[model samples]
Target: MTDNISAYKFDWPPITVEGYKKAENKVIMVFNLDVRTPAKVDHVIQYVVGRTVWCSLNSPVNVNILLSFDFRGQGIIVTKTQSLKSELLRLLNKANINNQVSIDFLI
Candidate 1:
């Protein structure tokens, strides 16, 4: 599991939900940064373990997802925020992400 995370090229910056909404368009999925190595990816996933969730006034409406990781593996991991919507949340939980990290929903 630790090997699956990614590290940022620069210092890990805080991704504010407010800032994401203001900056991006209607699309909610954004890969803010990418990692070039597996070790770096593991570092990122490990760092996200304790990160808190931020939401806007939209609540269960609009969502912003940030998938900051290194593409070391093959298939899609679905790290972005919007993909974790209520419906997707249930699916992920069923897929066994409940013990992974605290998921956040943005408005």
Candidate 2:
């Protein structure tokens, strides 16, 4: 095993992913409407919880979350290269959930 130790030395981006699927029957929703450092950190947990809920809705199939900051309220954007983009768009429209959803934090 010592011979393979060097394999772990490669430089990797700090990017990390945390969440799971099918933890609950209902889908949850949360997000950071803003990209600022302070705001992003402030709401990350709930936002991710919401994301997990969203992803888990498609259980039995593996799903990933792709989040980014948008200057415009463009809602969630799945990778363009993925075939699921169109399907997700239809789902959002059918639900009548607008591009911008509000986030409320309670003390």
State candidate 2's TM-score.
0.25
Error of 1 at 64 (Å): 8.5
RMSD of each: 10.2, 14.4
Q: Write the residue-wise lDDT of candidate 1 on 11-106 in tens digits.
A: 444444423445543223233334345565444344443232222222234444443332344343455334323333443344343222223422
Q: Using TM-score, give the best candidate's number.
A: 1
What are the runs in model 1 whose C-alpha is more than 4 Å off? 1-15, 18-31, 52-107
Which regions of candidate 2 deviate over 4 angstroms? Answer: 1-32, 37-40, 71-107
lDDT of 2: 0.35
Write one digit per residue (lDDT tens) for candidate 2, span 45-104.
Answer: 334333433444443343433333332443333342132223333434444443332222
lDDT of 1 at 51: 34
